[model samples]
Target chain A: MEAALTAGIGTPLSRSAADALNSVDLTALTPGTPAFVGAVERVLTSFFTTRREIVDPLGPVFVDAAEALAQFVVRGGKRTRPGFAWTGWLGAGGDPAGPDAAAVLTACSALELVQACALVHDDIIDSSRTRRGFPTVHIDFEDRHRAAHWPGDGAAYGSAVAILIGDLALAWADDLVHEAGLDPAALARFAPVWARMRTEVLGGQLLDINGEAGGDESVEAALRINRYKTAAYTIERPLHLGAALAGADDDLVAALRVYGTDVGIAFQLRDDLLGVFGDPAVTGKPSGDDLREGKRTVLIAEGLRRADPESAALIRTGLGTDLSDADVDRLRTVLKDLGAVDDVEGRIRDLTHSGLNAIAVSTTTGPAKKLLYDMALAATRRTA
Target chain B: MEAALTAGIGTPLSRSAADALNSVDLTALTPGTPAFVGAVERVLTSFFTTRREIVDPLGPVFVDAAEALAQFVVRGGKRTRPGFAWTGWLGAGGDPAGPDAAAVLTACSALELVQACALVHDDIIDSSRTRRGFPTVHIDFEDRHRAAHWPGDGAAYGSAVAILIGDLALAWADDLVHEAGLDPAALARFAPVWARMRTEVLGGQLLDINGEAGGDESVEAALRINRYKTAAYTIERPLHLGAALAGADDDLVAALRVYGTDVGIAFQLRDDLLGVFGDPAVTGKPSGDDLREGKRTVLIAEGLRRADPESAALIRTGLGTDLSDADVDRLRTVLKDLGAVDDVEGRIRDLTHSGLNAIAVSTTTGPAKKLLYDMALAATRRTA
Candidate 1:
């Protein structure tokens, strides 16, 4: 009924349904959209608090892990996965004031745990020393080992602790959903999507690792990894899960899929671009960190494809190797002059527009569409 | 009704319940009991088969991980965790012929995955070269890297893959329970126990790792780690989960907990004994591997506590270092002279008796109680 009135095609909506639409800013994106994402930080704190209470009695060292996991999660993240999920829920005609809202929030917040696991383990795999401008999980543990003068190789001990902590976060993520008080039917609907999300993200990550290690430079492989590694978890599954929670039908779900896929890919594209070009002060990471870590992103594939022979050789030499600031600047100039950055910018614009149009055709309220518009912009045009 | 007849102090069981009791051989333990364990092999196979089907299309390299996980799970394990879970369900009045029986099996079978996660990551953390007389997961991956000449430190590469594989196995174990088709009410009862089990096991594993790294050899700490690390996960939680699935009331659950904790700790004590005294051909792992690994078992704690000063110095020297055959023999003599070996064996017998007595007094039927008795014996007296 709300959709009918909003589309200007049928009888007026009931007062409650119309009130739901009127309760928030519909004409423009409310700045409070990020509030939902921020709310997850508190949920993480509570989760760890309760977990510490339970496991500390088992052992004080367990308490240490609880603290580490909580610190890692609450320390930083845009909570973008949960944000996408919230947007998807709103877009699927679910009212934020509805009975299942808190359950939805709890379920969505579990994404942070999944992301924590990925980042913690990813840092170890990459041998990355820093994340969010701080020592990554393994490195943090390593530093603790060094500080205490612990036995065994400090690096290996740190990695072991990080591995166990990552494992705990993943397990707790599963528990978060189950303990969220979703009815059996909702849980049944949620399980397969959640399971698939986990498998695909892991698969995508493995693909990324293998591509870099195996030196596979194919654009197709890079794009595939992009789709699964970031897109699937960041946007696709979150949308699917939210829409499913809102009891979305086939057409609405299908529409959200198209929107989420394009937008998510664009989001990752912007991240890749930022990795090379953004200032350290702005991005909280050293510029050209990707060049050093050798992320096999679509942008890199494009640069390799379009660069002149000399530039191509330089790109190859600099990829996955230590890069001085001067080397980063040289690669930046190549990316710009060879038209890779321009090409990627154009692709991002196209993907974001395609995603926005998909949202437009869906039967969600106008306000939901407007919020999604802002999300797509926030994801794609942040640096620009 | 079956419980009444089993204790021989009340009315006889109904024909079907009595028939259920008579269906399996209970006297002297049927050899077909291992068949229950062998069933977990198929579950792991099917788990990988379906997991591969879902992930392989997204990335073929994921198939490699699935293969590795399946190999690790199937290659070797006593399947003892699942066995204990099955026994718990049986002893809690859950009929094997009932509708929920298959679901119980599926849920219990998931324990194999948890154990797989532990073993895989434990091998990496311990830097163990072999498990079950075969290369461990990290070692196997390292060998693959060396064979392929992959572009990274083979050790780091191996650890990375093993970590990811272990993470996947942990996630899938959660999925196994969620997808097991337990009704909502059943899930509510089961979730807390499952969650606690995962947390405690990880906690226990962390504590174990920390103790070795910190080199604190206190007997109390060793026993605490033994309880949380192996006893709680291997015996207590499995029984608790099984009993909860059968809708066992608090009293019965408490009874099972007592029985499981005793039996489980005894199980680990026997393992420690076997690690030092058993033949490599029987245990599959090298004899005295724990001493080399600096495991800090209760027996070691006792030896360290009770050995004469010169013997203690010799024992400390032999701990956590490469041991020649003569060194191993000397450490063995220290353990024997200090009465640690005899003390541990005596504790195993007493704990096993306590566990068997707890099971005997429970309201489970005659055949179930008989099976429990044999299980305690098999777990504690399995040298042959």
Candidate 2:
């Protein structure tokens, strides 16, 4: 079933990977494991469904926003964040299928809700029209505004509405987390990670905005942004939070952090590559769209550093423009010529190897550990 | 300091009012009261200061939004929500000076932060340029966008940025509340009120938007909006949540609800009058602005129902326009001529009287009761 959800399931390597993942005895170890996953799935589905229902009570303006977010959230990507959280919980000797496990999943589910809110707001900031093969919230709302013949600019109204709805989602996420019923010590342990995650995400967003405006284009600055924006929240903090909840000691948590950091950065680097080169049908976004938005990715910075003066000028101009197909092809050629693509691919290999090594050396070993290792590998090695 | 805070306190004139409130002894509070009050004050002051410091971390793009929200929130408005929560805790026979008191105050402080988030977003929804004599967050951002040579239209970017910041604030509010260390039962007790408050506020906003856009905005509909939008969350929920935490019986809770409902409506009605007629210095708003904005207040609805045909048309056009001083005066005169102002005043009196009556027959009594009674009177009788 998991293989069927993706595009290239029949390839020998892909099939093997799927088999390896599925062969892990997720349900056999303890009844609690399946129960935890079940609880998370049930609660998240209910939360989002109820959210959809409640939003309509605010009338048409909110109805449009609720519909947009519902589609955005429900389009179904791999629930990697939740998976990582659950794995961490189990790897740290926590119960897989009990209430604590449910707590981990609940926290994980809330993280996705937070991600949804962040992405919706980010799309507005970037002015992108599509995400996950559907119209972005701002764009959807803007279209509705125009369709309804509202007096002002539909885009502006739509953007405004999207922002408010995103805020609502963020608020609701907190509410869900608080009601997760974690014990006091667990709650306290999780609070700092949660707080830091928010601050880091906001800081990362600020860095991204600043970089777009040519404020921080250095490789070092770009790496700093990646650490806060992608690395911390994506893998490191989630792992740390889950382990802490499961009563992992400081050294064990530190080991997980190292693994998470590498994997997180590698995952983002892969995404950067996919954003520029992946097939649209697979990635659900247009190739080279990130380049058109002039995101100050490490790949772009490296390419510029290696390019000739004239080519460098081309890269600079291409940073924030809506590049045509021809423009994207030219940029891709320049990147290849500069060897930036090879450099990024090499980094991805190193990061994946490092992360795998961390997991191997750690004292933890179980079905959950195996699953984490497989997930980290798949996350970094994906082509799209 | 307490004396200064409660100077010129008036006694309940009615026999029932005096009897219902006889249990309160403001002077004989428990030993921990001072410490609890001090902790809350310290936390609140630090929270605001920290908020101001962190708000503009990305430079001037966010500075205006930060400043506007800071000024609006830190100004001399009564901290009634927090006060009510604390008082309710006391009224329910909880120790006024214990850790519970601190917990209640912390929870109450979180409400202020939530309110700040809601108001900032609300301003964007309403498109009001000024709030409390300062430019609204969106407007501030819009002005900054124009002032700076940023990419897109300043207004659009401003609105987008404002929305993101509001989301941030909302998220932070929930974070604070969750970290307050309230026990599960305490948290659960407060959950429904918290949830309903959010729903009502959002629903009220929708009703306001729909009503202004020429929907079926009957007087009955306007009253419903008033109850949901202003009354429930603003007073009733805060009081009820506090009382519930104190283990107040159903009768006590119900009595507070009756009192809160009446006072909350009266509070908004008085605000409508002040919106049109109060001094700018006192109200922190330009006089007659509400007339220009064409807020769908009960006063306006009443005026429309009673005004002659010619006056009604003029009022309709004036509802959402940027009215000149002469236009505002003309509309006010027409409203007065139709006796809508008098009608609203009568309603306010009735509501206040009913609220006082509810308070008179209540079984619960304490310093908290006296404080509540005073607050209800002051809220309903306010001129500005």
Candidate 3:
């Protein structure tokens, strides 16, 4: 089963991954745009630099934590979240060269900081040791503590420092957005979305934790978590906020939200698949890590319901345990045999198709629409 | 030395404590200024109620923490901080019943939340089990975990839950202030001060943790921490912000700051003395709890500096241990023998006198000045 499926799908997935990357014309951005990008970059850099300066006076402990946070943020990712915000502003017939663009970017930059805080704290909670192919903040600090012969358990010290750093990052994110100097009315409009995003993310975290504690792992429960935890915050809220800041009308904002919600869920579903099947070299994580972590994904729940009794027992026993290569292979085969993987993939295609349909009807077009389309496809179609 | 102090003082401290409480017209506040007082109370109640509603969806773990926080906040304290802010606003000729008043109280309410988060986190960091005669949040959660037979160490679970709760509170504090509906110009002016206040408090915490860890025990270092940690945040910034929002002239803001700084430091010094020597029944805690917890206070540093070599070594060794009642007695004797308690009392008197003098020379006198004067004396002279 493994040889047949791998041979059938491997080449097409690779081509799709390459095609998605190729669609984003990184070089097509005008030279004039970098000035705006540079301004946003400068503000973000200054925001974090000032943060480091402020925390530096606190002590070496605070300094170390703040430095780690700054480093983690500055180390490049796709910057897709901020880019979505910037492009959304431009798509609403707003000038990217104006102060509004800088303001939007500044707010967008704060999203990254917020993301860093969430990721750090999430890693601590999940007991994850690595992120983006590097040791997590807690692990990094723990290693330092061990090297320095600290008086306490190195892991505990690392966790404590990571918590404090996350707190500081959250505070700084708010401060940066406040100081972005946007129109008062616009900022007022954006405030609730920002506030709700934080609340939903935290609420989603609570839901995730509760599910892992062996309470109701129903489809409705997982979908609720996905909506609040990932979909709304990661995509819908950011687009709405960007649009709101540009004085976008309700219809446009509503359209973007529909588009965002579909893309967000599709993105997460794709991530679940990759977590189980993608190569470690490409994903920067071990294959089958989500299964080992016993993540309460829709895929797993579907698989559990559809599998034969003997197979279901095997999965229940093996779900959270560290699995050998052969064990992972067997679990993957069972999941495929139960048709859970195909079912999830089909759902992803439905969401993507719906998202594209929404985009076609959207009043917004040109570069912003193009970028959003590319992003939506890239988010859902990735192998990693 | 204890016998000598009892013989010399003749219970003057007890009388001063009673006189301080009697002097404040807290009851007269309701009848004379019902609208103003009502506004402040309404704002605080709504803030906490809204917070509880928002956190309710985060599930039982978060709901438990939120309820505990709401309960702690609703059991109101002196309301001196909000009173100072209102007095400052009114003293600067701002209407007490206007939007500015609500803004001031909103900001003041946030200060209380900030204080709650700090106290909760501080208890976790210090491993203390009680606050304000109630089981601390961490301890309360730990007890709940143990009772429910939850997985993991009860203490770790308690700390984890408390950390998240504190994060939520801090995030809510920023949201409340940002959404306080102040004028744009006023918000722009207030932003830097608000940012600085948070940074300073964190900075002060760092100084304190370091000083305790390093065993510095220096009077200057402890006072520096008090200035940033308590003095600036507690009094100076709140008053100045209220004044700034009201568009007070720089001269008036400067004058209020001078008065606030002195009173703020005096307030903390009084708290330190109460923690070490105040009557347990009156203060609602065990006597000499700070001594048992080995808080690195100015009084302790002064005692060590002035004590004989043998006594100094004993004091240094005793600094961070849970001392017995008899040991606390001996520690008090050592402090009194070195005249450290008397020195602190003298410093408190000087600060109170200076604060009153600042208020007297300023042209800002009115009901606000009278309120500040009463607050200064009460803060410096209180036993609890």
Candidate 4:
């Protein structure tokens, strides 16, 4: 069934290579490890194929939309959530070759679907035009509407269709988890984790939007948003879910959560830094995109608090404005001079250290411990 | 837990009277029977209370949002989906006093949450201001944003928040089903039904928007959209889901689906008529709102097809445009004169007849058959 569903989707990348990594050496399970990433990609391909079949009778237009969603899922960013989940499962003494391994992989791959829903909806909410060097779903739809000379407001049509598409992605995410063939016992344990992760992420989004609308720029507010919005779903819950799936004890689960929270915050802090300073070529967005959007990140909050009065005024005025290259450079210099850049880097180091240390002291399997440590460094120190 | 959750939420209507409905006699199980409606209400209340606690720590604003959501779920239009599901269960010989009754109630009540998600998102997509005599979620949020003197565009914030709220409701709907404690075998049977209903409704919505944007006017297009958009989720799938939960055989499930489809379509036909000619005070909108919005419903499609050239030209010109009250009256006259109203009424009668006939022949429980017959009538013939 899996093979049939994935037929004509390009061949799975290096399954043999991935399978080879499973032989004798379990320590090679770091984040974005190709072995697990390949397995996840195959699971996603099969899932989308099933979805495409479900929507086929709706008509060519709907079929096209489903295909677009499928393509969007199959292509793009590092599968960080799944990678962490793999490590967590391994850390909990779950054997990759065990009978439950397939079910575990299927279950964890669901995080990617959730991520797809988030990015698709978030793009619509933020009115982002591009992502990963391609037009965002709404923008793509808007372009289609205009090119076809369709009646009505193109932008409204775009947003409306994108809303449905995002909704479809979300519904499909739940479906994938339910259909993953997890045993009833495992499913029962994983249910609340799934539920809480969903609510937490959405609640975090609500808080972030509310803060933006209310002009809330407190460092505390920013940190709180980061913990829920990016941290919990992205790392903490995925790890916890993996551990629970393996029937790991509470001690290990709690320790993993501690590690997850620290690492997740560090991940978001890295994101904040990248949002302002990363090259457009690497980030697929203009430099200082967050600043241009007046996003209230922890880095920005700290800069506001620490800068001199004159520099603070400059930072405030430059935010949410259309800045030239030179102007962005000027703002960058000010932030660096204010020591905000160094402060954030220092925080990331401290958080990563604490997170790794937690894992170090835990009863995590030796192989997964090394992988988790490697994942921490990669997550915080990546260029994009 | 249920009582505590429902405390301070106002008393459920006539629980004892409803309980009496289960005494030896079963024919009292008609759609919207107070007994089942009250139970569904209690389930929803408890579900929302749990959600409120989950979001409480987020702050008072979020708490208010959750409260508003809970209130909206409790106070609204007839609980039609739950009513149908209950009838389906009864028809399949489900025992109202059985151990599974509460679980079934909890499971079926999820339809209400799905409906909540649909209405909230639809209001945003259509930019509707009110529903069922109350301000729509987006409009309510927009008002709050304005009153609070928030910095961003109030409309954008309203739509964004509504999107997240809809997402939450959708997620909670799934959680309710998972938490309902349905046996694994029952869950397995019900999973596909639940999954399909979600896809069909969202797919229907995509079709509706596509029709509007692409100027699709064929009666075929109109009927197809109506079937998937309103009929499937609203009636057919709810019955199928309930029957599945009750472990009904496929033959009975098939019979129920046929009845559901016919009744569901008839229900939408009535709705289309109401859209054009219902009393504004009763429908909670100005007269001819659908005509003004130029919704491409079956009634409108038939009108365009059957009218004389002059009347056709008139409809083409008037639809989707701002018009005076006098102009609306003129359009109403043209539609009536074109026999469009009679055409739709004829369709409703025929559909409702076939729907009731399906139940008449089925091996459905005597009481449930009677109830189903009554529900078919109420669904097709009601004004609001």
Candidate 5:
């Protein structure tokens, strides 16, 4: 025990291991965009591989949970947060070849784990059965329990285990940042962004649940939830955190935030649209999931506000219930007829335009400004 | 948003606020014993006060949840983890009046929030109705949902909100430590301990649920669960974290771990005893709650191993069932008749003695050795 303590436990990713995971010739591509996504993915893989080793001794069940998390992290999502963070770094003149590059990259990669933590817990909260076309973590565990004929309520067991797994992801997220090898001064600047991001996301989650319970249907209420729950966590803080890690000036950080907030809100509005109307094959979720889950999105809120009495009743009845395809189509048609869909699309366009305008006016350097402009469009226009 | 960002959000504990909260002349009392508890509590109050302010603008519902968490943190528990952490610092020759004293105290205090997080999540996992004689976080939220006629499954809503609250507590725990003002080197050392502590606890929790679901009643399995679940998180890691914060020598840390491991196990063994036979009023839980939860304790494992076939049948039948007092008493008689209770008591005595013996041989400085000796006995001998 003493020897292990002295030697330090949970060794960082070895150079060879990192190289094998990241065979891409990162130097050949542009930094902080396509190249940055691969870099972040490699770090996530390396970090999870090391974590899996640590949990390996705990036995197979523990290993199973850790592996599920690793797979979820390595294969899931579009790396949206880390992409923004990297672009933010680039915008702030952070050199990908600088001495602090590894640390910066590691810290940026940690965002995915935070996202993993959020989605895992959110699945449990929503009682979501699947994500990315795979069973949700809790559902996975619940199935494991049922197959084993475990001596408990399988759903409860699944939820309990998922909760802990989410907790582990959150813990390891901080660990990754701590082990990122940032100098103290850089770390000092980074800590508050990290803290605030966590608070806002968690707080936003609480607000979401609270609003659901209170049955608040106002558009302002929905947008407020989106600001903290999605915008701050998904974009604003990630970009701010990256700039902070680069020791960016206040002006740069603020300018990037303005763009992040607008784009983030627009991104979520796009998600709201996708949740109700996108192809399940592309979105990797059942169509009308937001409706089934009764998600209080800006689109829904606007529809409820703008619809006539009969249309409003139809929208309200279709929401938060097990909806058939026909029911979903009816709701969709009503939303279109009432101009709710157009209203939301207009907002998305306006928000995206405003976000691009912010980037256009900023003193962002090099290719980053162009990337930022492109990303705003891409993020809002995505199918999934 | 820019102005708020520039001014710095979530301000630290102000001096006047700290003074008002901690009116105790901490200098007059011993640094690491009774006095340390109050210091940690004071820091917690200040931290929560500041945190509440940050969440205040999120609206009343967010503030209400945050307040519940703040109350749980400030008023709950015996502060056992922080007590050991403070003692660990003292044993490592940390100066009570040193320039880093405030930072040390704040970091030590953060352990309580970690405990709050674990307990909050644990209650939801266990589906326990009450904790410390108060409705558990989930139950409180469930009641809130019911009272408000909230649309949704009240229990699910409660669990979801509690999960967010716990996550918030966890995120804030890290924030407190990060904002504690540790130097780069001290923070670097502190990082791994914090990381490992979280992993061990969460992993231990997984192991525990896995054990219960699998019905692995072997004493070895039970003890293994105890080793990681309660012992490491409650004692060993807290001490290790404090020692690391003080940059203690490896020898001293190893020695303290030895004592911590032994005492921590003994402490858990005592808890197992209390969970069954102790006064419900004193334990702040229902009588035979552990039996109802079907917790695989060393005592229960031993009883199953040692009992006759009919007695074993009795034990198995009673283990996880909802038992009347008569049934509980019958099970208690069978456990005692099997000598399991005696076996556990003897183990507690021997472990406590071994832990005290380690303290006697260690190079731990000042009054810490004596305090550790007393704490080992108190921890293992208490009824609750």
Candidate 6:
């Protein structure tokens, strides 16, 4: 299953290239990948530490709020977006070994905070009780309220706290970027892309939420939503941001967009398949969450496209349903029988190749190109 | 009641200065004042407009979400925070006539966004049904969901929308600043204050929320909350931000803080009194909203302090209750009878004078200093 595709690279590998050649996993092999995320985690710790200093003068309760957000940011996340950003910077001929690299890394770090905000709020929107295999922020706060025997609806209180924390994370992400002391001209150049990413991500999310309420059933419509929600924020925009930081010209940025887009769509396709059919132990989510949420993914759209009328109706019922595990299994078979599963897998393979080819034709350094190519495989082919 | 305190300054007011001198009402006068707020309002409109352009490319439903945030930003708020920020820039010996003035104004405009985020989420925390004379964002969304024949809990959907919008506002505030092309040095100088304001406001909000849940009832505790939530973010940080933009010395920053603290606390204390006593038409809120929300203001703490056991019990009963009009009126009498109203009034007067005196001792220019003095009166003494 670890289909280390570097097994087929034609060129001889260097020391850094060896890591790219050695594994297809984004999580374990990338140098300072752990350190990059760890740095962000440490920054998160210090953010709360500094906040507690200010808030301590106010009250312990305020510290409690800051700590909760800090924990949320530091604890979860795969740092996938930031990893792409860093690679995009490196690929755009930016010196990873330069002093500006730290600033760029810090800028990359901001994405994690944005991701954290998205996740917390997404959970609230979906009424998801868990994330990363733990109680979600809203549920955690609800439990705190209930435990404290606070007046008012525990759910309401939980939602309020979650809202504030999400807002705080959004604010802090900006704070982190400005604090990086990046070149002003570079920052000015980067603002539009950064602003676009933030708004597009939110827009994408709104579309997803709207779709869950039963808007479009077409695969084209579903893919459009996925393009904005998953592709832009998760990969394309991040790569664009890093490219901007690296002083990338329009042509290079355009090339990365092509690479990021195709790769990004494939990434979400894999996630959608996993949501229904992947093991909970591998996915770190309860099995069939997409089915429970009635996610209108392209895979689901395709399934409905091919199903018989009665079968399609039964498939529709699974959207946002509280079905038994066996019922979910039965629906899984219906999707497989309709050829939706096979269709998605085929599309993912084609998309991944196009994405890898985008990077290959671009004027990126060989090592960074290998990394991006590896990242694409690792992202779309992961079990978890 | 209009205590026109253009006290004995030797010079005749310029046309612009005349407007500043003519009225102590912040909502009404000064050159760029109405025009300044108007400018910020327009900028806010364009922010969502641009977002709509991006989001529209995604889907009509996302455009719906963007439009809601834009309208909320445009249709409401006094632009009070930006007002203070712009004045602070002028007050710190920064030339209003300089080329960089527009940048300062743009920087000042960011405060309104922070304010919007805080207000939306605050309403959620307080379960406030209306703000600025309309259904709060959550309630508006809830009504829309109910009307649209959408499935699931309308309130939850509404809350989810409100949360996302608030988070967007927070993110956009940062975007606005970076997009303004402020000097890197000045931006760096301003970053800490901006960061501090966001976090402190959140901490303050948590304290206010915590207090309403029966955590604190003393005047000291309430004032502490006020210092963070209202005073710091409202006046002090705005002034500090403006002063930073102007490259003001630390002494000037500290001086503005003193003024902002006194004026800000006075501002909120007046609001507490008005929650029970002000005219709804003037206040632009449902009469007694804060009272209904059971906000733990210093005024309430004062009432609880001097109240007889029966009166205190009556006041306690009003905290977080679904009180009828008759009940609100009765509790209003308890505050008045206990001399809590008068006590708060006295504090307001003392604080306003202290604020004015703080500005007088600072190294601010005359016209801008005059503006700050007038603003203090305008903020604390307004009916709304």
lDDT of 1 by residue, B1-384 (tens): 112112321111111111222333332222235666556565666556656445666755778887888888888767777777777787788777776765676777788888888889888888889888789988988898888877768888788888889988898887777665567776677887888788889998888888887746788888888888888898878888888788886666766777777888898999888888888998777788778766689999998899788988988778889998788888898899899998898988888887777667778657667766777777788772
Off by over 4 Å in 1: A1-34, A307-309, B1-34
Tens digits of per-residue lDDT for model 5, A1-384: 345344443323232223322345433434345566677778888777766545765667678888888888887867888877877887888887666666777788788999999999999998889888899999999999999877768998999999999999998899888877778888888887888788888888888888877757799889979888988888888888888888787777778887888889999999999998999999878888888877778998899899889988888877889999899888888888878889889989998888787778887886889888878877899898
Chain A TM-score values, per prediction: 0.87, 0.82, 0.86, 0.88, 0.89, 0.87
Write candidate 6's Cα lDDT for A1-384 as tens digits: 002111211111111111111212222325336665665555455544544435566677777777788878888876788888888888898776565766676677778888988998898888889876689998998999889887778887777778778877887787767665578877766667887789888878777766666466799888988888999899988988888899887667777887788889999999999999989987777899889877788999999899899999999876787988998999999999999999999999998988788778888777779889888988899897
Interface RMSD of 5: 2.9
Model 1 pairs whose backbones collide: none
Q: Where in model 6 is the C-alpha error above 4 Å?
A: A1-36, A284-287, B1-33, B279-290, B322-330
Give the DockQ-based CAPRI class for model 1: acceptable
Give Cα distance to truth, residue A296, candidate 3, Å. Answer: 1.9
Q: Could you give the TM-score of chain B for each candidate, in order? A: 0.87, 0.80, 0.84, 0.88, 0.90, 0.86
lDDT of 5 at B292: 79
In candidate 4, which residue ranges exceed 4 Å CA deviation? A1-31, A279-285, B1-31, B279-285
lDDT of candidate 4? 0.80
Q: How accurate is candidate 1 locally (lDDT)?
A: 0.76
TM-score of chain B of 3: 0.84
Report the candidate with higher lDDT, 1 versus 2: 1
Q: What value does the lDDT take at residue A71 in candidate 6?
A: 79
Candidate number of the best lDDT: 5
Worst 10 residues of 6 chain A by lDDT: A9-18
For A1-384, candidate 4 gives per-residue lDDT tens digits of 113222312211112212222333333434575765766787888777666545765677788788888888889767988877877888999887677776777788888888888888889888889888899998999999999998779999989888888888888888888877789888878877788788888888888888888846778888878888988878888888888888887778777887888889999999999999999999777888888888888999999999889999999889889988898899889989889999999989998988888789899999889888888888899898
- Chain B TM-score against the true chain B, candidate 4: 0.88
Candidate 5 regions exceeding 4 Å error are A1-35, A52-54, A277-289, A322-329, B1-35, B279-289, B324-326
Q: Each model's TM-score?
A: 0.89, 0.82, 0.85, 0.90, 0.93, 0.88
Cα lDDT for residue A236, model 1?
Answer: 74
Q: Tell me how far the alpha carbon of residue A129 in candidate 5 is from the true structure, in angstroms, after superposition.
A: 1.0
Candidate 2 DockQ vs. native: 0.14
